[model samples]
Target: MTSKPLISVIVAVYNGSKTLQRCIDSVSDQTYPDKELIIIDGGSTDGTVDLLIANNDKITYWQSEPDNGIYNAWNKALNHAKGDWIYFLGSDDYLWKRSVFEETSSHLFKAESENIRLVYGQVARVTKNDDICCIEGDSWDYTRRGIVADGICTFTHQGMFHHRSLFETYGKFDESFRIAGDYELLIRAFKEGGAALFINGLIVAGMQTGGVTANCTKLVKETARARRNNQLRVITIPWLISYAWAICYPSLKSLIGDKNSRYLVNSGKCFVAVLSYKKNAILEHNNN
Candidate 1:
């Protein structure tokens, strides 16, 4: 193997024909010279496979087979990655431009030691319908040049570059979760990982956002279990409020301030709060 491959761009795709070609094009266009793009396809029935086959010459390593879930496919790609650093760029999401590689590499190489395990610049998260979903603001205060001061935002799986050895120290992402596994990893990284770097720049990633609350119930349940399994940050104001915010507004519910609606929402909110604390405590204790 080469001495230090700078970055490993891993992508897990499933029936992604609608966006796979664009995603592949972005990787192919990256300006960085010493990087690898590992693509993992989960037996896509759509023309996704055909498209990938045509683009096979551009890919370093790729596999197409059924996997349990998205995270599982990602795990496979990680194992095959040889880059010194890792970045997970989803198939449905595209980079802001070809300069992403050049820009990201410049900042990442500044870290002389292995202690800096991660870095996240800004990202313009666009919706799948060709609409701007969130237009993030740059911090004007010189003291606040970066949006995320710490790994609190580490839970966000996109718009970041991570050290490859961080996985060896902290371990790869847990494949058991279908959602919010990123959250679980964020907590772990912040709690046990090394120093994190921030660039405070913006790259665009087109994400499908309508299902924000589509899986709230399942997310709540899985989170409840995960919290129990890895209890940390119990009684923290942010954690408590996170629990509250996760279930406070139901998309299917009536308008706010309705008497019965308020009660129901409050009740759900309370349940979330208790579960949050209990699970957080449990997980934290186990880690200790």
Candidate 2:
């Protein structure tokens, strides 16, 4: 691979008129010259098509059609991409800065020599209330921890830049999973010995509070199912408690008349569960 390989920024949208311009502009404003912006719109009717038409000069390849789900749309994007590295961006998300791709290129080139299939950086989660939370990408150790503990997701997809060969090697995202396909794909890649490099800068700013994964109950259940399907041991208690909290937290707050108290209780439970899992893992390692 070349030192500065072509990067494909793929975005799949469905009626994303409100935020599509922001996403498109972010990619257009990127300082990286050898990049292509490929957008696969799922037959949007909310003025998105007009906006796309107006910006046809900016987009390398774009098509609007009905698709089964986001994964299917992504698969379409992959088919049209001509770049060596692929970065998937959400319609609601944007690149952290104009220099994101420029800053990441050197690390990606080094990782390429080491045969790494993925390079990821940190993402700043922009909540609905405009609160920002930083989520870091995973190292091998962090990935191993996630395999053992079901409560954690090792990385967010928004900040990750994947080699095109990874899809050819491990297959595309499983279209059957409406919510947890990204998680499932990551687990499968790691299990198949696909190495990853974690870069040290912010790549994208993702909106945290919306989308299909926003339903905490569905997310927790799907995540557990993904873990089980990957043959990773699932810790039932933490997930069960999390599900219950998602469902009952509002009622509990109403009864107690204190939101902070409920938040603390939920946070404490999760903290304790993480500690317990870590303790058990350490014990098992020492015994072995």
Local accuracy by lDDT, each model? 0.62, 0.76
Clashes of 1: 6
Query: How far in Å is the alpha carbon of 95 misplaced in model 2?
Result: 0.5
Please tell me which predicted candidate would have the highest TM-score against the true structure. Answer: 2
Point out where model 2 deviates above 4 Å.
Answer: 128-130, 133-138, 147-151, 192-194, 201-203, 236-238, 241-245, 248-281
Question: What is the alpha-carbon RMSD of candidate 1 to the true structure?
Answer: 8.1
Worst lDDT window (10 residues) for model 2?
257-266
- TM-score of each predicted structure versus truth: 0.74, 0.85
Each prediction's RMSD over C-alphas, in Å, is 8.1, 3.7
Tell me how far the alpha carbon of residue 150 in candidate 1 is from the true structure, in angstroms, after superposition.
Answer: 13
